[model samples]
Target: MSTENGTIGSQGEVNGDVMLTHFRKKDDDDANGEVETEETQVYIENYKDKLLIYGINDSPPIHVTIICALQQGLLSLSGQLIVSLLVAEAVCASKNDAFKARLLSSTLFMSGITTFCMNIFGIRLPLFQGAASEYVIPLLLMADTDQTFCTSEPSKEGGQSPVPATTTMSPNFTNSSLGNYTNNDEITMDRIIYNVQMIQGSLVLAGFVHALLGFTGLIGVMLRFVGPLTIVPTLTLIFIFIVGPVIKFVEVNWGIAFSTIAVAVILFLYLAKYNMPVPVWTPSLGFRIIRYPLHQVFAILISIVLNWLLCGVLTYAGLLTDDKKNIGYNARTDARIQIVRDNPWLTFPYPGQFGPFGFSGAAFISCMIATLISVLDSIGDYYACARVCRVPAPPKHAVNRGIMIEGLCSMLSGAVGCGHATSTYGGNIGAIGVTKVASRHVFIATGVIYILFGIFGKFSALFISIPYPVLGGAIVVMFGIFFGVVISNLEVTNMSSPRNIAIFGLSIFIGLAVPTWAKKHKSPVQTGHAMFDKIMSMLVGNPNLVGTIIACFLDNTVPGTAEERGIAAWQVSEEDERADVDRTEFNEGYEVYDPLIPRSIMYSKLMKYIPFLPYKRGNVEKELGNVKTS
Candidate 1:
């Protein structure tokens, strides 16, 4: 569908009808449902040709183009994973169907440019730009839980003896204090700083595998292997992974955090209550809700500044003495003075540091295990995107492109010395859903913001200034939206069980409230991850978790992906017998028209057929017929 334009139109569509089937729409803002005439359509198609004619471009956005960037700094492990997912989204989203020619070019140049600036200017790697590793869990479990850092020959119990006097390290590496770490126990900072450059090896390997899989179009098969249930847990993990940390943060700096949150709420209310001003921020870059007050963004801005100032003061006043002074903590960090002495400039994380540290029989095994989890996480992420995009599933190529980019970034991170594997986060997906602008270019714009930090270095304080509580507030609000979406995405086949629903919420409650309460009460474990791992270990240290068990039961094995498992479900369909309905959906070319299928899904599928350059409308009709005839 189109509207009147100068000579033609600008919107998403397939020019070559033979292979490409495009279903156009008038953007939601265009309330008028005027259809474009054939003549106008032809002109519009030619215009698209001209855009492609200019030669595709995807370099990092100019440094001065963007104004601000949101940095998820020092989150809980799960939160870190979610944050990494978000970071990956900002990066990978830049690579649309053009095979990321633009994204690759942009990323390569941006990375190099940033690396050079930090090297030359003696500049800090703007604390603003951080790549998170969702796979750090496995890597951390291996490296952090390893015997290398321990003192007394590593016993089974948690605490260990002081170093043997022969070695330089202590018994409990997690407890940096044991070895006289100067930065107290800033494990999050220490872990990422020391490990950033090393994770690149895992990233490169992951990228290679993902790219290979993409070329072979394995994403589809892999997707079928993962099911809604697996997604449920993974997403739940993601939610907890994301939101749990926020709650803990809220608990820690209650005055600063809660105050920041209160203002954010009031700001949201004001914005929501007022008549929004035009172009407060672009609809693409920010959500310009008609119902919300445009000025609340400023409230958020003010809150960020005030909280930072307060935190800076608090740290000075001994309120944050634990982390600032870093006395009897862990995470292998030394004092501020020592950090300055070891390396004046914080180094970017390298690629190979993440996968079991060194290449060994055991290291290899650990990396492989980590890789599997990465793949699993990636699969879930892809589906969440697919659901959001409204495609039944992603085209294999798209999946590969996305995954390869994710792995590639991880590989690069390994080289950079960070503990991150940036994957697409459902939380960001939630953001997109809330904003309702899924243009890949906008995320590309976001990555530009990430790259800009190294170029200009202005936004670090903006990020630094954001109070943990305010960040927590934004997270809780958005994730609440996402949790709703996931539940909506699922079938209620088992919803009747208060027990099952409780089981689902059990994870959420345990994951969120327990950690926050534990932290507020001053538990021995500093971060939520430590508490979670310890709790899970106590409850059941099963190599295969409850989620794994359910996925196996419903799907019967790691059939390798969500799609393969889908086919299995398809084969086992008792829908006809159960509901006594006709099933014409299997035969190829049968078209089923369901008005309920979101337009986004239809459009996404159509994009896949574009490269082939032509399509048979009858085939789509036939495809729809199968479902309709049913």
Candidate 2:
């Protein structure tokens, strides 16, 4: 291990036992990539009060920061685009172009602001925040409950149809202005507006619940029971559940899908080991040549660009068809050009941009379930992200604050009529691992990029046509790596033990199987009460939640010691070489109070005893006693 003075030994960081390995290296050299400790010391010292990373404060050049930010920002945009489109189709019934445009603008705006909050004050990591999939099922259930809101007929001008059970609605429904709709069409718009209002109200309420969970410190206590076994399957299912969507896109154009996938693999895997020398000027050091992994850094974006170029060439050659049904149709270029021509150059999204808000019991209950799932999934993301950044697991307080920030974002989404919620994107989190660029400043730049994209409506619209197969191919690579990351957490666990194997095996099998079956069957889970049944069906229907719950429950209930379950080794301690030995250090780098804010509740003894306050200071035994009771 490297000494605290920042000197390295010849042995280097290594371990033999796979079942007892820490996820990240303890040495500073490996932890901070090529950047030295003194280079990042100023930023870390400035934010000494919070849990900041070398990546966040490591002052990369302005151009490097912008490039990294844009790269990570694109990954986040892909998820937001998918969710915004789904909301336009599922909730607006492919009829209200105004609502669709408003939803897209609002989410883009909300995501930018929320992500800024998360990086600065919440998780204090390089995690990219984006639209979450947890709300999709609940929103779909809400739409199904009121068919009038989503009912549609084939358009006279275009081949517009109702959102199919097998496919998302085509964008052709959002080609005109709301004023174009006839008197009868206005009535349909009214119903759709009402439905949108109900969803907004429910999400607002759910956000409050999320805040309560964080404030009461209940989330901290819950974290005690979450082990690597539970996390492995939970994180794995996130990617596994995307199989349906990936298959749908791949089936559309196998050639494009294969090409995109091939490029991503070649860049990410094949070229990953090679680094190119870049010249840089430093005041003290004079000049230096840094071997940067340029190819791997731009792998995902490069793969997409290569595919896009091929598609454009085919389009020019007249080999690409205009028919939507044809496999050779260049949807990427066509959609981009069309949206740019249709939308305004600039548009600003504000509160209540769509219509008035309303509430429904069924929608509210379903949203609560969605909130829980989002929280659970985010916990796994926190761990995985920390691992990639070469940091220890976040402490109770940081996790609580992270969720609270997400709740705030959710409320903002509801207010803005986004019809969906925001959460940390696992795909982007995994990218931190793939690209090995975990700079906090880069992500801050990403937030700025998102905001700029949102403001320039035409600018955002241009990317709306990103080829489906290219995106699908990228999804496959990201999710595949995410699954590998989840399994890596199990390195500390005794995989050879039949008991551990059974726990992981059963949790994963059921998590994937239940959701697949539920989606195919489309049968409502009955619980006698209508509202209760709707909620149950929504919760049970989601694959990620089902798998996580099963794994968490079985892992805790089953008989085994902490070591046998890998809990002991998976966590970090003060003795670890990478850890700071300050008494205030409470699991990882997260402190109990913000040094910048003296009047913060963290300073109060009464608050410390409240359990979820994350207040770890003097009179520790008293605080523990109070925690057990409160």
Candidate 3:
């Protein structure tokens, strides 16, 4: 055991010295002031402190970091593959199989590059960047619109076809329209290219808007208005929105879905507390024993493998039929097996591969809202990652840089024609919490792995073919926990206060209410202008965006004390004059610009006021000193 500052840490000495129980924060205790019985000491002493490993840039053993990175990278890739599949299913249903595979590859490629850039230059945390779920709604909207547009055209009857038709014949001299019958390959390519171009346009526009916000540091100003009330409903509504899609997929094969949920719950929750003793062979220390939480580390991966095995077994026994004609059986089978065969073994993502970019004002407007949603989601993730990593909450500049990188990479996503934007992956934050390994180097390695794996089209297709039921089952657990994490932030607020209660209840109600209403009445927000109407409709339809905007407005304007609204604890600012010094000293996750570089520019007398740079020592000290005296 050891003590650092005021915090206590202990290694697990579980077998003999179990009396040295796991330490819990006072806040974790019940009214009786007793710790939970499930937690106990294991092997390492001061495990939390020792597990700190390398603080951001402090180099650890190459092998160790590599292992950690590979694990995290693979998990991140798996999650993105699922997301890519979802996006493709929604937007590319009428396009060629190869086109969908290309979209998946492009998303993977862009995600890897974006993650690497952000880790190196942005927030520099261990957060994994991938396809944002918030953008899925907009993509689906575009797909639906495209479908309707095609159907409305008199020339194209039966607008929905998975694959284009092929026919070969000599042009009949008697028929003038015979010349217009193009080959199936050209028709398929044209449809795929057109869709990609439109999505690319929206992504580019949204990225530019987000980058501008981050660059001007305008997003930081908005953060002050966001309190726990704003976060809780917004986050919960996000999960609620996500659950609709999961239910749609899972409902296809309830038996497979239920089985998946059962296995996942057993592995992730039931076996979470059980640790297995394993022998560790260290070169210098010889063979020693350690108790490891193998279940926590491999819960998702194991659950998936178990479900896959069950699927295979059931199919072989004829209990679960494998029929392309049946949606239920298709949900459980590797129905996308053709994607692997169609795409090359190895292919790199090239910008404009789908053809020239095309712009749509309505699509751009929808994407703008999605970008705003991503911004809000990323902010919550920033705080979550910091908390799990045992670091102080991010200051304004760090948050700004993170968003800036997100925007910049979003542009790259468009350039690569991924048809979706990139943002921090909530799944990876969960992974860090489970493994308790918060090394930025590991994420850096993960980024490299993503880039490498993305080049292999077959690998992307392999994961893409994972049963939809399995994916839905994982989403149930993941989104459920996501909702819980957001709600848990309420602990800082005075939940019993009627004023707080009203705000929370109203925010959630409006969030759910608006989306439900918008869906039932499509043109609810119609202004004569089509683009403006589309934008408002999209915003109203998204529960997270609506709830967040309403909650932020109420929390900032409503008559309530800072304590009642949870702002005081949620945004814990120090009155110390060394605020600038504290940021420099505490940021172990990623190196912000060197202290010397900012100091060199400080002679201009206006550098500290800038949004991208770190706080100015002189100005911060002056303001903080005045506050201290007051």
Candidate 4:
């Protein structure tokens, strides 16, 4: 592997056994499109740190963007646009036409950038771009289908439309924003065409960076500073940031929220009691007694179904509001999609679309921070792939090459009005681990799908229409799951220290609660913390203004003295340590850290807290050892 140190090995691995272990599927004769199994993901690292990365192993990292996507959709707007563009470029830049690594790498990179941007800039760019994992196989199917169908289809003028159909090249599709399953709408074809140009623009940047890195050979230098432990925490923090906003949402929309949660619970149980369909055929569970795919798709899907029925019931009971304005903005948006299908392309950004573009300065200024986050994302994604492949693709230079590809792609995506930089995501890694299919060729197929989706924007519209509450429910589960995962990952060198435990709890509490209070009061900053303008006579100190300024520079920007950040990071670390210990104790074991499984160790916490949950009347001093005895 190429690194700051040097080339350590070929960085290429080809073991029939490891492949068989992680990548195989029973139904697929052609294993290239097969799904990755949890077993394979479980085997990624073979050392102590492995335990740390998996965070109790059995669950998903729900915190990061999944929580953010549903609540604010901040990242969904720009972040999604950025990653999609970069991914398309990365896939296009792959040599030997091997695009899978480029796409998968983007997933982790997206997560990484999300972490880095928040820490480095006084910016928290929304990081909700999930990996385009689910779409890969479908694109592959389309690519490999008969030329008569996949390449060119019959026209819509009755039978074949009588218009001669011609085959066209598919746009590279791994562009993520192109294929999302939005909130509450059906997929349409118009979106597919518009995306092709956007996807093209995003990749244009990737090609430049790839060209620069490939020819200059600077890929080796970037790998030295990054590692798993640091990255894991940042990603973990993402969930923290996301969950805070989501919890507030549940509190605000209790009626819809409760119904949504109930639907997810029922679906999880149903899937557990019976066999269900999964790509390449699969069935498994570790916690929530719920199958993963079912939770991912049907948790929200079934919730919507039940909610619609409930909508009717509420109407019958005279408790439902008849005001269309209060129902939600989704219905009109959905109808708009159908109306705009034929003329959707007319909305694309134009150079002079608004005035002469002379002083469009604020537009770029406000978005400048967002653009940089995309770079961090690109860098993170490259490292994730470099680490996993374990061997340097070019004898220790692949990371640089890979990043360059994404960087240039970012510029292109930005020019096209996407503004968000392209990066990788972790969600896609789950897909890779489950499917075991690592072929770049299939990724290219996926890229083509994105292009089509971009062209047919209605597809995105359908997902966008899904109600916020249904999304809120999914975010709740994911946030809880991510909390479990992060807590599982929260290990420290000195866990016994009291100071550490206090710090851990306080940091988590503050981070979550501060955001909570702000969201509720709609007052992100207090008047005392606001900036004051000192006129010629006197000064006006607005706490909210000062707080806003401080909030902007506080955690991210290099504000104040070194003493400030060190103290803060350490104090937070202490709190994190306790949370980690508690998380570990709760999960029970290495088997996916399934807390759902009955285990004795988990009871120790409640018993420790209340000193009463356990049936056995064990002495408190003995149960908690140092806590009570000391």
Model with the higher TM-score, candidate 2 or 4 = 2
TM-score result, candidate 4: 0.39
For model 4, the superposed segments whose C-alpha errors exceed 4 Å read 1-255, 258-320, 327-368, 371-402, 425-450, 478-630
Q: Write out the backbone clash pairs for model 3.
A: 11-44, 11-45, 11-46, 12-42, 12-43, 13-42, 13-43, 14-42
By lDDT, the best candidate is 2
Global fold similarity of model 1 (TM-score): 0.51
Q: List the residue pairs that clash in candidate 2.
A: 55-440, 56-440, 217-612
- What TM-score would each prediction reach against the true structure? 0.51, 0.78, 0.77, 0.39
Mark the 10 consecutive residues where model 1 has the least summed lDDT: 586-595
Compute the lDDT of residue 99 as modeled in candidate 3.
49
**Residue 71 error for model 4, in Å?**
19
In model 2, which regions exceed 4 Å deviation?
1-54, 145-187, 277-290, 515-535, 569-630
TM-score of 2: 0.78
> lDDT of all the models against the reference?
0.38, 0.67, 0.66, 0.33
Q: What lDDT tens digits, residue by residue, belong to model 4 across residues 409-468? A: 444443332323445444332222212222222232333334433444444444434444
Better of 3 and 4 by TM-score: 3
Which digits, one per residue and each the tens of the lDDT, describe model 3 over residues 1-630? 433322344444322212134454344447765644433333453232233334555454577678667656655554576567667655443344444556677888888898898888788777789888878776676555443433311233435233221221112211122122223434433344445566787888899888878889987787767777887776677777666667766776777777866875676567666665657776645687766555555565666678877777766678765767777775654566777777678877766555456676767876887898788888878877766665666666677888988998998888777878899887677656555567778888778877876798777667666677766676565555555556666877899988788888998899889888988875768679865666667667778777888888888887888778776654533233234445433534223322225343643457557675565455545655675798
Best by TM-score: 2
> What would the per-residue lDDT of candidate 2 be over residues 92-168, giving only the tens digit for each residue?
64655555665777788888888888887776777777887778766776556444444443233333233221122
Candidate 1 achieves a global lDDT of 0.38
